[model samples]
Target: MSRTYVKVIPTVALLLIAGFSVSAWLVYSTSLGTDYSKYTFPLWTIPEGSHMYTQLRVGDLNGDGLDDVVVTGDYSLEAVFQNRTGGFENRTQILPSGSWDGFVLEDLNGDGSLDICALNATHDGTYLVTLSNSGTGAFAVASQYLLGPIRHVFPYRSHGSDVPDVGVYLLGDHNHIVLLHNNGSGHLTPDVYLSLTARNILDVLAADLDGDNQDEIITVQDNGNLTVWSKSASSRQFSNVSRYLDTVQAKRSAWLVIADMNGDGIQDVGLASNIGASRGVLVFLSGDSINVEQPIIERYYDYTWLGALASDLDSDTDTDIVLCTQQTVLVMENSQSGQIGGEIKFTGFITPHSPSVIALAGHPSPALIVLAEHRGWYDLNLIDLVVFWREERGILP
Candidate 1:
């Protein structure tokens, strides 16, 4: 890098004094092509430096037989894009402006219309807000209640409601889980806070691990071990006994993704690890938990693999993998027999942190949405989220 300075000013100094001069500078970067040719488009973008700490949630919120997307990265700039045929259109903004942490789309009200439940922020305290869907892409303020800061928000059914209850992970060093109960009218009420671990947990996945009808809470610690807590639907509290996979560093990496790679009905788990002086991924096979100490698949790339998503990237009908690296996206084919093929890396991303795999309405194939924060940390003044799609394999069946 070289330091150079050019001086040019006052050519129109008298014009500036006469209020008739202007000076401005602009820069732009050209987009690149991915490894595979697919249907890719930019749905929407916000002001630069907006933190997409939470991934965009895609589903049918309006009940119009199409998938819509809701993004809450820019606090007071929450926007919902309705799946208009094969393309997405800006339907409306969830919040005009403000500091909102995260949000979830669930039927907070039993009105058969899916509502927006968001974590609103304020100077005093963060709040839980319920915005009812008046129609497709239309949301009205249902209720807003104050509480502590929320890192992650998941929906669960408690208090005997037809809809699921709100499960939140508090933002703190301590590992505490709070369940906010609904007062039957779509309003969230304060409920019990349960302590799950001594230290902080990375992420929470709400799913039914066993074949049982009840839902279970799965949390992964930094060390890569997992703890499964059975939830009582009626009581709305964790069961006294919990299941644990106390394997010795089964997940040697910081990232973890759960999916059934072998076409099994049960959901298996994948824990990423950087062991043997290289990057690796361990599989905690769901049924009998196969190869506990050994990893079913392992691979290394040039940069850091921040996150991984389990999806059928190709039309093979088997679950493939999408790895979100610091600079590119890698697609690995799953042999469906515990083997992974070589990596097919895709470019056109700058400091990409994570990627979300979603099926848009009208589009037959699932698409990958990656939010990039320029080259390093998130800058509130620059923004870019690219979408990659395929036409052959429509979204998962």
Candidate 2:
């Protein structure tokens, strides 16, 4: 070969190598350009055996800037765990007798101080709504409301089965809901019981479903029915605005949550159905009447009985769904495009019976608070509050 020909061949080889190098560099840059910082994981599990039946985070619970947790357990025992330097310290305990079903923390009395609403089920099959607050590390009950006798009050009895058994170990019973309203006198009014029908009501939540300023009540019946009751603007009375039955042919109990899933300003409903085959339904409301139009149904593999469902995961502006099965937890994203995304599996964790999960929005980024019973205990065992974010380019900062 001639010298010029050899030089031309070498030049071509260099050009080919340069082209490949540039292509690889471009591909690597594009791959690293993604914003995975939003998926980072930072978890803080509450002290073991706190028996946190319900957990709510509210700011200035002890006149401090940090958010404090209000937890409730059996025997109407309500405790306020103050958010100290890094961990929680028991602050106060209130009303230790009737077993509690659900709880809420708010300034119900409009007193600038935070108060609590406890839904207590008495031993003799009666329901009591207790309102209390913490003063100098002790609880002081302000008022009590005797919510009429709950229809099926026995524990562990099937829905609509009035067995009338008084065994404390029985767990399947209809629990009453507790809703708090402030009387604006530094004292919370009695909890208003909102039971539409005599059927077993599973979960109840309060949110502004419509664009109205007042908050509405969203209840999920054990028979897989979603009911939205709007609070009257003037009278403060609850009126049944709309109801939606599971279009799917299945009899199931549902755990429901209300949030703006589609970022449409209006709150949408997320229902986790424990039907024959476990599945979840996301219903988006349109207009101001709780008119649910878009229904997205997602069925999980295996016997995935969904216990608790929460939204706003991944902090993507659009809401996501977290489903707690007996063994694993699945996180489903709401793409807002009418199509559901794949799942983020959280394994190696036990979701106790009646597990409750909520997104903690009080932090810089959102975290998840999961309330579950211990491996052997019947009461609440562990409170795992985890904050997650994503990192890109192998750097979290």
Candidate 3:
């Protein structure tokens, strides 16, 4: 063949191959949902004293524009600051040794800085310790309120106010709920309190489930009972109550999360339970009425799930679930019709606890943070921070 003909043939073949490669990639990107490309081996390990880390959260604590991690454990409150190199090597202690269970970050004093409300539940009594952050991001103990026998405290905001109200869920003999109003002074006082007959309360969360301006308090209890309370017409307290039973065979609710699972505007409920034969994951689709007979999406697995978090892992508009089971970590994608779609699994994580989605310091997209018992190269079984993110949105230095 002539030289000109050979060169022309090679050029045409190259053009066709390039065009096909681009087409293939487009199809794969559209079809491939929930692609968690890489997983880091334990970002931070718990030492001897701090054994079990219960809660983990990431935020711009120092106002450096880069997100930092804050964790709570048995009598421990630590912060992992992200440095200039995008590495979390600079560790600091936020609060002195105390039995800190969980905390919420909010601007309690209206200083535009996120303050910390660390809840301490001890045998003496339960207390809400408010840590006010100065303009320079240094937090000092501002005030403390004695909330008797409350197991969990969550932030509840209503009427579009910048100030957040605190929701306290009382367990044991109290068996009640209280809404603590923040009066722009870092002091939380009981504004409204209600007594409930529901026993064995596992978790309590607040959200506007009916798209109403008012928020509803949802409580997951034993014997497959899910009770919701709405603010009364007087707006003084939560008096209107509705109860749902046998929700996905979830007798004993382990963990609960409230988010819009589907693209629908209403927020749905997610539950994880390891009670007896009912060990599985369940999602309650919120409609005009969330009754006991409401539709539910459930999946039963061999291993018990520790917790589940909702995030749009595939860039799909709808939310998906990331479950941390004792056996492994599973990512369940959402379908176009708002059902559970594909499954993505990650192994080798022992006793994985909480799975959270946070925007890391260097990553553009949100990353998944899981706390798991890792037997690392040192051969020590310690709770480690397992981080994972999508490959396309690479982690920057």
Candidate 4:
């Protein structure tokens, strides 16, 4: 089968600057100073032709301190790489045949061991791939469930929108969100199927939107609607909690992330819309309720494309926005005054067609930002960890 290549670019450099600002705030106290001189390692490229798409997640599947990398490819194969002292070692390849689109790594079975949930392109379905952290990283196919049905599938093409349609060949259809639950006993099951009104569903994120301990589902539809769904404790089923926001005009592509953008205890939703005149918005909620007081932040960027992940790049309490434009990755800092701070652009960095993923430690320290680029052959690029001290201080050196 011929595989399609997508170039994953890092969002604008505003995220890097945000990381520096946060680090400076933590160390310097008053002045904003960063140390970019320290060099840990040079930029290196991983093996090529991995057909990697989307952001790569780093976690220790074997209980080792070193993080293990999990990535989905254009084909059905999902690769697991072990992070060694110098580079990454291919540990195992699990699935062999369908196109894998989206993936999440979590202890779904509640077993303390991390497993993977992967979305298949061929059938608009999801599969649970279980990894036994036993000695050598052995993997097993747990379960597979169809999310629902896709209205239309489109081929992978760059129609000026930052959102890439994995391998969908058509357009104009309703996509379903597939949530997988580990059923223990070495099995996985589909927990929720979310239907949306938009032509396409760009991304689905899980977060504690309300005070409830369970994570709520937040999906960004192609029609620019941010739909929030919560699971019932008794039924273990998902229902639409509320339509958080539908302020923006319908756009083909957008990225969604859940973060406390305003330093409030509640998590806020940040939508990075990659329309022709690229612009982003931050919607802060009082709680899990759809009552949004101020949805839009004052400062907006023109032609700023949204990156793969919308996260708290800077350690600031608010979630920062990352945009990868034609040239430069911009990182915007969160401001209480409703205005975003200055942007930090990283020159000389090439973004793959896939989105960049951020690796955060449970404690305070610099986190690794993984960018998988397409270099003729499939190769994974490891960008320098844009360090941050506090969530508010911004990106550090």
Candidate 5:
């Protein structure tokens, strides 16, 4: 497969001055300082042939121990396997052109191979489609269950089960969470409601935030509040709910990422606020208990962050923050105290959405992959799978 490599081009830098003059009571401390233009970002774009791409999932699909990509779109389901040259092969269409939306990659059948659980929206209704992988990059339809319109499907292990279940945000009428439990037979059974009252569900993340042995389901709502649902020992279901980010500082929450931002053992929550006057990213330093009142706040005056991911960008054992805007990619180094230190800006991404991280087989650092749509030659519409193989200074081949 052919790939497009564009040389590093310097983009116009907009210096964000610290301290907001809007509110005097609000102590405006800037973690991301005024230094915007420092290093050139190294990246390459691969034309995966647009299908109105919606989501991308990474895993070892071909059993090569390399992270392969499975992409879902409005009219296509495709897989791009990583080759030995630290690149990808031509994308293979996993299913015929269809209305595919949110999907996840996991071992559904317990055959040790990763399977696909995808949501397909059709003219009739939305359906949960399960595709069984043959451990050789080949997939076939295992089963399909008619479901309501869903936003996304994620891997969740419910009730201490060995099999990984699938959870999704069931939208329309009343928004809530519904789980399609894997019956250990490679088939998903629906109608399991985790939270019937979850309103305006924007994103869902599964992690053990409170040091409990059970995994907690964290959901970000459109109202800029976070709800954490933990499994009840007596009920055997996720019934215990705790709400966070219900502060005046948080408004119109764009997205949330969970990781040990500091060297602290507990998992911290990083949130990106997209709207309101104080729009920026903040890190919640979690403790043995849920801390909802206070967060280590950081604000960018002019830039609007759409999405963010927490990862150790320099392999320094401390988690760094990577926020995506329409124009540039922002990297904030994490101090040991869960505060931002230095920042790097990578420009030249058009309409970038859902930034992800994947470590190739022979690469020393993980690569940042983003789904971007831009116009190609002859003014044709193109969706490019843009990959950044570098950090602040380190570059990958």
Candidate 6:
């Protein structure tokens, strides 16, 4: 398949003018700066016929030892781009994995290769399909099961399991959380399922909080109440549900990402809500298992709508947070002492839907991939992470 290439024009300059002041109402102190005097960003083109490339997952899918990406977009469009010498190349088209709106890629079979798990939307009925990697850039449905309507799908290593298993959060009045354990083959067996008292549940996340070496699932109800569920060792079920965060009223459109934000080695939580005009993002730093005494911190910005991703953006050995408005992408750096500050801005546009940080095969740092839908283009731009050396600036254009 031929890809669509575009001329990349970068306007970011290296200057220390206090800050760019993209958001005039930010409440945090920021001196975060970027030196872009050395180079231009590299663009990885998508097929011209592709609809909005909605979801992306990166891995060595074809066993070529090169990084490849699996993407799904409008009209159930799906394909995989193999990393080649120039950019990405795909000789043939990849069929959709049952046109599942949500999916994940992981080594589900304990085999040493990546596999694809896909599912249709919640409104499209209930089915979870597994496509096993045949080690030849092709996939075949190894197994499938009727999972009902699920809003989220993720693979995780449960408390005592060596291999990662699948967990899904059911949608609608189902109010159930289901787990499927991988049986060493590319198949999933029904392990545990639990029903909640409430309905309209949306998203779920798993992380090892409290540093007990056991992970707990974090979720939000449609009513804006944040809660967490833990696996009871004695009962062998996901029980012991408790309220985690007393969040704002505008939460139905909100989302949360987990990381060790406080440098505590324990995973903390951050919530990005599209509801509030004044409150930017709510961060609950890692604290006690039951409650962190003073956890909530509002890293203020002026944007009415926001979405966020938390990763080590600056290569500071600690994960930082990235937030994007309709027109700009902001990076919040984290010091080794867990201090979150020095926010900087990048001169680009990326929607908050799915802002991805991808570590390319050859680069020393990760690249930020975001779709500039506002620019009225079908392609996306990559912000390459380059190290700033004083001597290299003179040689690089």
lDDT of 2 by residue, 1-397 (tens): 0011000001101101121111100000001122321221112233454434443444446666444555555533434343433334554556656656555555544445655555566656544343545533345666665554532221111112222111111123434343434445433333355445535666555555665555666666666677777656556356788877765545465666655644556766666665565444334443244445435433434433446555554556666665555444555566665444543433323323324343222322233333332323343343333222222212223
| Residues 205-245, model 6: lDDT tens digits | 67777666566777776566667777754455776555754
Runs of candidate 6 exceeding 4 Å displacement: 1-53, 64-66, 82-86, 91-93, 97-99, 121-124, 232-234, 277-279, 304-306, 336-338, 350-397
The clash count of every prediction, one per candidate, is: 16, 13, 0, 51, 0, 1
Error of 1 at 59 (Å): 2.3
Q: Please give the TM-score that candidate 1 achieves against the real structure.
A: 0.70
- Across 1-397, the per-residue lDDT of candidate 3 in tens digits comes to 0011000011111111121111100100001121321223234444564545367766677887766677776666777665554345556678857677778877787877778898876687888888888855577898888888778788877765668888888878888888888886778888888788877888887877877666788888766677778874358767655666753444544666665755667777766666565256454545445664554465556555566666665565566667665445555566634556554433433321322221111122244343433433343434455444343333333
Q: What RMSD does model 3 have?
A: 11.5
- Comparing 1 with 5 on TM-score, the higher-scoring candidate is 5
* Candidate 2: regions farther than 4 A off: 1-60, 76-85, 123-131, 134-137, 150-181, 186-198, 235-239, 277-303, 309-311, 315-317, 339-342, 351-365, 376-397
Query: So what's the TM-score on candidate 3?
Result: 0.78
Count of clashes in candidate 3: 0
* Candidate 4 structure, TM-score to reference: 0.65
Give candidate 2's TM-score.
0.62
In order of TM-score, best first, we have 3, 5, 6, 1, 4, 2
What TM-score does candidate 5 get on C-alpha atoms? 0.76
How high is the CA lDDT of each candidate model? 0.53, 0.44, 0.60, 0.46, 0.60, 0.53
**Candidate 5 to native Cα RMSD, angstroms:** 10.3
lDDT of 6 at 208: 71
Worst 10 residues of 5 by lDDT: 22-31
Tens digit of per-residue lDDT, candidate 1, span 1-397: 1111212111211101111111111111112253321233443455565555544555677777655666655555345453533445564666776676677777777777778888877787677778888766678888877767666778865433577778787766545777777776677776867776535566675665565655566667756556666666566467524434434453444545656655566666665544333344434445335324444444334344556666655555666666654444455566666556543434433423223221111122244333333322433333334444443224422
